[model samples]
Target: MFDTIDFQALRRIGLSQALVAQMFNLQTEPADRLMRVTEVQRDRLRLHDGEAEHVAQVWPTLRIALQMQGESLVVGDWVAARRDDSLGDVCWAAARVPPVNHLVRRDSSGLRQVLVSNVDTALLVMGCGQDFNLRRLDRYLALVRLAGVAPVVVLSKADLLMDGGASRAEAVRRHLSGQVDVVALNGQEAASAQALSPWLAEGQTLVLLGSSGAGKSTLTNTLTGLAAQATGGVRGGDEHGRHTTTTRSMHRCASGACIIDTPGLRGLQVDADEAQLDAVFDDISSLAPMCRFRDCHHEDEPGCAVRSRVPAGRLLSYHKLQREAQRHEMTVLDRQRQAAEWKARGRFAKAVSRAKRG
Candidate 1:
């Protein structure tokens, strides 16, 4: 089925020569079609093969294997699917094409959840109004950096902010200090969407992440020049927007960039390591070498460049994120130890029962 797709058409959906080569080498049945996952539902998936769109599902066995491997089919995933021999209209996803990069987060239960895969850029959207939160933006940037994707801070609702949101954008830009791109724009305007055109080049994929009232849907509509995703207004008093996007979906833009729209996340926990946090705060990371102690926390330590040089608020936020990452790591370790202890107890009880029987 992939034989009919041309290179130009495939490129529009983020397929490259290297990815095509990988698909060709996959040991799947000849009848299987190579497709990109555009949307994932509870029991079904929407896929595009550069020629047409199809609804597909993973078979029982393949689904079990996907779960066992700790992998999931999210937006921007390329997969191999076979047309059901018995059912003419049905297609079963046989295998997934390995992603070059993926953005993920830990849930309250500590399970990892995949957001978007094979994405080149992450548009960290935040509104200029009450929806803006620097602490949350830091978390999003850390997660995107952890996945090795370029992060662009998108300040939406520019029309609502004072001075066309210039002052606010400058403040955020200064806080970041040339670390990442910060674009402030009205999501409803075409001119604003043009500001983001640089990242929307052909063969590229960008995912939107933000809170419910952050105007992600509006920006997506502006980017695609189509109301592909729904939009809603924030509450009158608090400006908290109702969740406009309930599911993750991808759309191809006129510029040939694939954009993935995600639901406004209420609880975004960055599941990152120490190195990932350092990359997000490179300024502070660079100062760590000048600290007096090798493992200095930078809390009242002598010659602590991080604490002395960086702004107090920014430094505190960095420390908070680092501690958060450390806590997440420790939580995983503790869970593993607890599981081992339970297994040992089970074995000891079994041995005692065997001795009693003897």
Candidate 2:
């Protein structure tokens, strides 16, 4: 039945020929249905099979297997499932179809949370007003760059800018130094959405990233040509807003590209390697090779090319992200030591409890 589905329809849903081939390879049973996860919930998933949408959940055994593999399903992930008539329109998600690539971030616990899978571009949306911050943009660029996805910076609410966002956009461009494409647009306008049309070509996938009231939902609505997501205004003083979009969701844009809009990220920790951070700061990274000392800290050091050429604030951001990355890279010995310490504490508490009981 899936074989009979038109490729064009599947393309609209972000299924490419390569992904279709991968789906076939992942399916073991003839009756298994191939579906793309559009929305993820606490215990259930919303899947679309390019024909119909269904509420789905992973089987018990499959859940255990996925846990053993340290993998969990997220939006934009292709999966193999089967229809179960007893569940009254629910399907059993059997397994995940491996993504070509995926974007992930670390939670406060340092556990990996896969945001979206198989996206080609990441639109790092920020407001032209009080929401614009180069440091936050750099962090986003590093995350996407690490995932091997192209990163684009889109400054929304240009209409609110005093000089039509031209000066602010130029400043952002100078900060980035042409490292990534930057676009300034009004999220509610169709013509403004057209500025991003190149990356939204058919079969491509894009994800939106920003803080609250950054116009992510408005842009998604404009691109999809549907008022699917609710938009809200920001506080005049701080430009902050209540969390309007609470979950990660995928939509098919009018250009046939799929877009995933996620909840506002209040705190972003880049789940990346030091090398990835360096890649985002290529100016500083390039000068590192010219430093006299191989392991130069670039602070009051002789022949420090990086220190001499790179701006202090930019270098500080690089160092900050580097420290964060190293902190998250828990070694085997470190994890074992942590576990042993917890166990020792637990045993000591148990002994104290036994003495108290006696």
- In order of appearance, the predictions have TM-scores of 0.88, 0.87
lDDT of 2 at 118: 85
Q: How many residue pairs clash (N, CA or C atoms closer than 3 angstroms) in each of the candidate models, in the order given?
A: 0, 0
Give me the runs in candidate 2 sitting further than 4 Å from their true place. Answer: 1-5, 330-358
lDDT of each: 0.83, 0.83
Worst 10 residues of 1 by lDDT: 1-10
Worst 10 residues of 2 by lDDT: 1-10
Per-residue lDDT tens digits for candidate 2, residues 249-353, read 998888888899999876788888877777767878888989999998777789999876666766777889888887678697987887899999999999999
Clash tally for model 2: 0
Q: What global local distance difference test value does model 2 have?
A: 0.83
